[model samples]
Target: MKNLLVTQYQDFVRWLTRRLGSSDLAQDALQETFLRLEQGSSIGPVHNPKAYLLRIALNMASNRRAADNRRLATSEVDKLLDLPDDAPDPARAVEAKSEISALKRALAELPARRREIFLASWIENLPHPEIARRYQISIRTVQIELKLALEYCDSRLNRRNKLRG
Candidate 1:
């Protein structure tokens, strides 16, 4: 049974990594999933091991995507956008810079988990089941977090617009 599981595990991980778009992340999630399975964590059964592992892989990918988004969003602004020294229009450049700054500030204000859900869903194009699995939470929770985060971001941006007016 153990050897069977191990062999199945490799095939599952390969399918999952291909689906999720990152070999390193797929391997990490595969390791964790097998560890859980070995400990008898009960993620269901092996009849559909591919489907089961894919679900687990999705969750792991969502978590990593969230973390990477946060890191990118918080890093130095100048480093985020690489523009050539030649400025076609100085005024447009300044406005673009200001908009980027505003976006960064808004992203920073959001709670980490909320931010992660929003980015993973919207920017990374991850499905909700994968996100829920990654966070070990329910799909409902993922939906709620994303909705609230978007509302919060919208409100904040509206307020900024009013202040500018």
Candidate 2:
């Protein structure tokens, strides 16, 4: 969404109008483009938001054209357009929330070193060797800590699940 802030929205829509050859289609494409961008907030930062948006928009347009082509050629492909995205049921949503809460509590309970190593390894995407080098520990030590952290979380979640049941 931050990357989208760099572009003047009206300008992108105008460009899309020229490219896609229909104002209505351009509007639809622009809305879909931003929806896609909103879905991926982890896109951090980009050097050129305009270029990124253009690429995504172009890809979206291309995909739509391809889908239309498929619909024209095959009856089965046309049915795909009518299918709706299924939302999770309330019970499933509640179960997922409880599981996530248990995981968060388990993560909080981890010892500082193991937690740090665990986060760096799993969340931050730092490699075991990189974490070892950064923390001035052997790679094997990083591996052990991460393993213990995962095991602790698993046991805690399993206990929580039994209680819930």
If scored against the real structure, what TM-score would every candidate get? 0.38, 0.49
Collision count of model 2: 0
Q: For model 2, how does the per-residue alpha-carbon lDDT over 1-165 read when each residue is reduced to its tens digit?
A: 434633577777788889889777766767778788678667766798787887788788878878877665566657777788688889989999998998889989999889999989878999889999989999999988987887788898876334223
- Best model number under lDDT: 2
**Residue 157 of model 2: what lDDT?**
81
lDDT tens readout by residue for model 1, 1-165: 345447787776677778877788888877766666678654544686556666766786787788887774544676656656675598988987886676667778999998888888988999999999988999999999987876677676665333223
Clash totals for all candidate models:
1, 0
TM-score, model 2 to reference: 0.49
**Winning model by TM-score:** 2
lDDT of 1: 0.74
